[model samples]
Target: KIQRQMGSSYHPEVTMKIQVPFEEFTLQIEGRADGVMETDEGTVIDEIKGVFKNLDAMKEPVQVHLAQAKCYAFIYGE
Candidate 1:
C-alpha cells in the first residue's frame, strides 16, 4: 500500500550491497529496503515496517529505524 502511494517509480524490495574500503577495517553492508524511489531531488530509501495498531501510537521514528534509514542513505551516497 505504501509503495503504491509513493508511485510507480519506486521499485519494490530493492537490495543494496555496498563495500567501503578502509585502511585496515573494511566494511561491507548489504540489505534489502522495502522500496527505492528516484526523482529530480535524489534517491530515497523506503524502510517499511508494520506494527499493527502501534503505528498510530508513534509520533516519531524509532531510534533503530532512523539509524537504519541513515545507513541506507549513506550507502546510497545521498
Candidate 2:
C-alpha cells in the first residue's frame, strides 16, 4: 500500500544463491528478501518485520536483521 507513494521499484520475495569458501568446503547462503527497491537514493533492500507486542516493547532491530539486509545488498551488487 505504502509503496505506491514511493518512487522506488522493487522485486518481491526475491532470492539469490551465493557460494562462500569456508576452509575446504563451499558454503551456500540462500534466502529470500521481502523486497529490493531501486530508488533515487540508490538500491535499497526492504526488510519487513512485524512485532507482536506493543511498540514500546520493541528495541532497535537485531544484528541479524542488519546483517541479512546487507547480505541482500551484496547480492544485488549495490
Candidate 3:
C-alpha cells in the first residue's frame, strides 16, 4: 500500500536490493526498499506499511514500525 504509493510518486528508474548491518545488535537486517527517488532536494527512501484492522490497535505496532523506519533512515542515510 505505502510502497505502491511511493512507487507511484517516485517512478524510480531502477530497483535494487540492499542489506544493512546494525553494530548495536547481533542481527543482520534485510529487506528491499521500493526504490530510490532522485529529486532536487535529495535522495529519498520509500517504505510501505499496510494496516488492516482497528485503528486503535495500531498504536503499539506503530512504535515498532517507526523504529524500523528510523533504523532504515539511519542506515540508508535518508
Candidate 4:
C-alpha cells in the first residue's frame, strides 16, 4: 500500500550485509531494508513494519523498529 504511494522514487527490498567490530571479534549483521531512496540531500533508508494498533493513536516509533532503521542507515553510511 505505502510502497505503491512511494512509487518509482523508492527501491524496494534492499539487501545489506555488514560486519561490526566488538571487543574481541566482529559481528556479522545481514538484513533487507524495506525501501531505499536517493534524494538530493542524501540517501534515505525506509524501514516499513506492520502494526496492529490504530495509527491515529500512535505517537512515536517503536524502539526496536527505529533500531532496525538505524542499522540500515549505518550499513549504507559505511
Which number leads on TM-score? 4
lDDT of 3 by residue, 1-78 (tens): 644766555643333334545786555555555556756798776667788889876646678777766665565662
Tell me each candidate's TM-score: 0.70, 0.73, 0.48, 0.80
Q: Which residue ranges in model 2 land beyond 4 Å of their true spot?
A: 1-8, 56-59
Q: Which of 1 and 4 is ahead in TM-score?
A: 4
Off by over 4 Å in 4: 1-9
Q: Which candidate number has the best lDDT?
A: 4
Question: How does model 3 score by TM-score?
Answer: 0.48
Please write out the lDDT profile of model 1 over residues 1-78, one tens digit for every residue.
Answer: 766887878888877778888899888988888888998898878897766667678899888988888887887773
Tell me the lDDT of candidate 2.
Answer: 0.76
- Note the Cα lDDT for every prediction shown: 0.81, 0.76, 0.61, 0.87
Model 2: per-residue Cα lDDT over 1-78, one tens digit each: 655655437667778668888999998888788877787788777788775778787677678878988787887783
The full ranking of all candidates by TM-score, starting with the best, is: 4, 2, 1, 3
On the 0 to 100 scale, the lDDT of residue 32 in model 3 is 55
Residue pairs of candidate 1 with colliding backbone atoms: none
